[model samples]
Target: MMSDRLFVYGTLMRGYDHPMARLLSSNAEFLGTASIPGRLYLMRHYPALVPSEDPDEHVHGEVFRLHRVDEVLAQLDDYEGCGPSDQRSEYRREISQVTLDGGTELDAFVYYFNWDVARLPRIVSGRFQPEAFSG
Candidate 1:
């Protein structure tokens, strides 16, 4: 099976310094750290991505190759309250180009949250860090 690759910049990183680390396995490949040319900020237990008005702002995270994507995607859907069917859920899974720390960009599927439905303040301005996101 082709491995399901994803980009995880916050808690899902290897050292898993984030509490939600429990939500995933440590064996997942920590391909490398990367930054999207956008502004990122702390939210409860996760980071929030918003369109960067500034051309130079960045969002830091790592790329991961998931073993069984269907299962993981289902779990992620539950976690994000996507209902395994809701297209309007905050976190939407999509494929996009992600760049590594050294500037090498790769294609991967990432679960991104729609800030509007998140019902939380823009992280860059709020600076709220939580171990879990329940909303």
Candidate 2:
């Protein structure tokens, strides 16, 4: 069985408040923190990741080696509102190069935002820190 890998940067990252975090942790090997070149955004409730060409911008996240990719992704696809037939979904799954904390790089699946972020606020820290909504 081939093990698939995924990199989650937002709610899916361990220690977040999202319930999906537990599901992912139980089904995959927690490979520790990793980062990739991108810009993070606050898109209402959750954060969105947009590709960045800037070398200085590295989006922080976690890496997981999945033993049951097909099953895991199917569940994640629903949570992320992504699928093979959903072109209108807010996020789209794509393969990206992620660098581990120690500098090891690996190709992993990532969910990229599909909508326009022109007016969205950029998360300057590159880390998605979840907080309670003041509203």
Candidate 3:
């Protein structure tokens, strides 16, 4: 997979009322909405994506064709609490296949949560909208 693409959910998704969303939108090409097989959890104020073994479950998000992978990833790593060599990083970047609205699939970089999910609430809808959960 090329380093120029990313699959972002939660705060990074467009219209999510977050700084990271605005930052990414201004610098990356918004490919469109997409989904991958995963489970979304309400991790406090943000969200976490964990790969799901169930084929029917999906995590709704957006896909972007990034122009500056290094720069963008650097900022994202900080926001995600991830480090280049730290095993304690909250998230780990990995490549996964995401299916677009019209069923086109593409490999993109996804930040998978690295912590335990014993208590996180599962988003049954497989989608996370800021307005829906924000107080």
Candidate 4:
């Protein structure tokens, strides 16, 4: 079955003033904080999630239940640079299991980095800090 939940780990997360973030807040219900097995890498002003096998490695973020799935996802797809028209997308939306703070696990859509992360600096904390991008 298709899932209406989405896990956002970067600019799209709450507390950010990004327009897309606002779009998300207005269209989805914030479930709560969650974590997924992955490593976060700083990609300029934003961060990227790279799946990790290490049990200790996890990326922290928030999960949301999309009220208008198709509409919201369509805009998010373009914002994430993974829309159908994007010949070389930077991220790919995939379904993954995320564990909420309350210990509930659910399938959610995650936008994962599609390129090599070899040269990027990994966010060892597994959390994206916007201040890291400050000049």
Clashes of each: 3, 0, 0, 0
lDDT of 1 by residue, 6-69 (tens): 7765556666554445555543556776766555555565676654557566666777776667
- The TM-scores of all predictions, comma-separated, are 0.69, 0.92, 0.94, 0.95
Sort by lDDT, best first: what order? Answer: 4, 3, 2, 1
For model 1, the stretches where C-alpha displacement exceeds 4 angstroms are 1-3, 17-23, 51-54, 83-87, 117-135
Which pairs clash in model 1?
A: 9-61, 44-130, 45-130
Q: Give the whole-model CA lDDT for all candidates, comma-separated.
A: 0.62, 0.89, 0.89, 0.93
Clashing pairs in 2: none
Ranking by TM-score: 4, 3, 2, 1
Q: Candidate 2 vs candidate 4: which has greater lDDT? A: 4
- For model 3, residues 1-135, the per-residue Cα lDDT tens digits are 456899998889877657888889988999999999999998887788899989999999999998888898899889899876888889999888999999998899999999998899988888887677779
- For residue 82, give model 3's deviation from the true position in Å: 1.4
Model 1, poorest ten-residue lDDT window?
A: 125-134
Worst 10 residues of 4 by lDDT: 80-89
Question: What stretches of model 2 exceed 4 Å from their correct place?
Answer: 1-3, 132-135
Write the number of the candidate with greater TM-score, choosing between 1 and 4: 4
Considering lDDT, which of the candidate structures 3 and 4 is the better prediction for this target? 4
Q: Quickly count the clashes in candidate 2.
A: 0
Q: Write the per-residue lDDT of candidate 4 for residues 33-115, one digit (tens) a residue.
A: 99999999988878989999999999999999999998999999989988555646899988999999999999999999988
Name the top TM-score candidate. 4
**Who wins the lDDT comparison?**
4
Better candidate number, 1 or 3, judged by TM-score: 3
Cα miss at 123, model 4 (Å)? 0.3
